[model samples]
Target: MTTIMSSALGFASNRRRRAILALLVVEALSLAVISALHLSGVIHGGTRPYNPEAAGIAEAVIGVVLIAGAVAVLSSPKHGRAAAQAATGFAIAGFIVGLTFTIIGGQPVDVAYHAIVLPLLILTLVLSLPKPRDLGVGRDQGPVSKSQ
Candidate 1:
């Protein structure tokens, strides 16, 4: 029974890990497209004059970081968790700043994009957090057992 429960938990963890990776990939692709659109002046919104090139470049960098995080997650869950956390945190901060400017600059499309993606990023960030076991929770302080 314990073995069966362990297997089930492992399967669920794997599924959740895959889902997080998929979200990261989708987000990176979205960022790439958004950056390209802005760079091409196709995403111009509102009357405020701002530098689309700068915003596009910033977003492209974030996308690259996200891709790296995804690759890391695929290779090693332990290290990848940190990478994903950093990437998502960075993205959240960037989006918040971007959203602030977008709202103040009166860029409705950009504002909408931030609105849609920001929450998803936050969710991904939360989901990628380490489990209690990973943080030494409920861990034995005595001599380690072979099974452990």
Candidate 2:
């Protein structure tokens, strides 16, 4: 579609797009740090009161998913929006689940940070993404949406 193509090509009109890109970078870095913490046993926010091993595994999985999503975005600028959305999903799940775990066994501040802050950031970025229809050549306007 023209919208996606134009965004892919220039994306000059919306300055927020750059903010989105920056957030995506932050997400990638956060995930990597989380992965390192879990795998290397350097998790933050006080001592582990619950099952650290399980938490570590979960964190690693989330890290991998986010990294894969980032790769998808970087690999194809024209289709990066979808990739970013997918990454957001992983971020949402990780934050919620991690929040729950922290609330049950860790500090209240950790709970607040995970439950309130992280998800809001992720959702903000997700909502900021341009819809596929905005791409100008959406499936609805293509051969698939046409009746035979």
Summarize candidate 2's per-residue lDDT along 25-121 as a digit string, tens digits.
6665665665566557665454555445566677667666666665655566655656666777767777777776777785554465466548655
* Best-fitting candidate, scored by TM-score: 1
- Cα RMSD to native, each candidate? 6.3, 5.6
The regions of model 1 sitting more than 4 angstroms off are 1-12, 45-50, 133-136, 139-148
Residue-pair clashes, model 2? 3
Q: Estimate, for each residue in 2-75, the C-alpha lDDT of model 1 and write its tens digit.
A: 21122112312666678889989999999999999998988775555455676788889989988988997788
Among residues 3 or more apart in sequence or in different chains, the pairs in candidate 1 whose N, CA or C atoms overlap within 3 Å are none
Q: Which ten residues in a row have the lowest lDDT in candidate 1?
A: 2-11
Q: Rate the local accuracy (lDDT) of all candidates.
A: 0.77, 0.59
CA lDDT for candidate 2: 0.59
TM-score of each: 0.79, 0.61
